[model samples]
Target: MSVEVTDQDAALAYYVDVLGCELRTDVEVFPGGRWVEVVPPGSTVGIALVTRESGIPVALRLGTSDADEAHARLTSAGTAPHQAVIREAYAPPMFAFDDPDGNALVYLEDAPG
Candidate 1:
């Protein structure tokens, strides 16, 4: 999962100091970009704090066993997906869609361990 925040520092502080999530990863991946992830206690998933300019979509990402099936189900239920399931070498199969309230979300096919 990930969230788009205007300020990474403030977001990090809130998630860690206030929310009690542990800082998982804090590294500068590029000259001007930093990757910060926080995980709740006893949880395997981490929430990545990113900026809009970071090229990471600000969406709630859910894991699905089959992206195609998930997409079909959502489409059939009248939820219009933003696009078709994308299969790329750099990432898992996934698709983006908006909820009834228009909040962005994504469903990613689970990657094998």
Candidate 2:
């Protein structure tokens, strides 16, 4: 999947450095734009960073092995502060945070196998 970002360089740093995603591809596209792809380790699904004239609200739900640990990692990385994990009877443990371009994203604990 793709997410629109105003600055590809900043987005790349955040996703790769903060989020711990690996860089899959980084290339220049026609008409003066870049095509950058990143993915979590061992995950086939990748997120493409596309340039946009205007930013838009995007929600990306990501599954984590452990929500608490993920939240802590993000917190320690200085990428998240206000987001707190929510636990409910019917809902899985989850938390939400925004990217540099204000794109909303949710991190949820993977259901026990």
Candidate 3:
């Protein structure tokens, strides 16, 4: 999964430092543009910081076998933790957090079918 952020460093810090994702690469497709992707440790799916500026909130619903555990990790890193995890109709076990620039983000797990 990919999402755009105002700055790559901020995004990387949050995704890496706070979210415990591993920096996948230093690959730069555009020399002057934001170009980096990070994946949650032991997970193949990744969140990318692109150069698309949009007002629409980017909701990247990421599911983990361990949401409670993930929350602990995020909070332990001193992120202003807000408990947004909820499983409801049309959505399941989703939560949100903001980046340094207040770009809305969400990672959620769906109810079992």
Candidate 2 Cα outliers beyond 4 Å, as residue runs: 1-58
**The best candidate in terms of TM-score:** 1
lDDT of 2 by residue, 14-34 (tens): 999999999998866433756
Candidate 1 lDDT, 5-113, residue by residue in tens: 9999999999999999999898776655677889998898989899988766788989999999999999999999999999866568999999999888999999877
- Model 1 misplaced regions, further than 4 Å: 7-36
Q: How many residue pairs clash in each candidate?
A: 0, 0, 0
Q: Return the clash pairs for model 1, or none.
A: none
Each candidate structure's TM-score, on Cα atoms with residue i matched to residue i, is 0.71, 0.48, 0.43
TM-score, model 3 to reference: 0.43
User: lDDT-based ranking, best first?
Assistant: 1, 2, 3
lDDT of 3 by residue, 1-113 (tens): 56767777788889899989999865544345444778898898766666565332354546766566666667787654456465554334656766567666566664466
Error of 2 at 39 (Å): 21
**Model 2 weakest lDDT span, ten residues long:** 50-59
Q: Between 1 and 2, whose lDDT is larger?
A: 1
CA lDDT, every model vs. true structure: 0.89, 0.77, 0.64
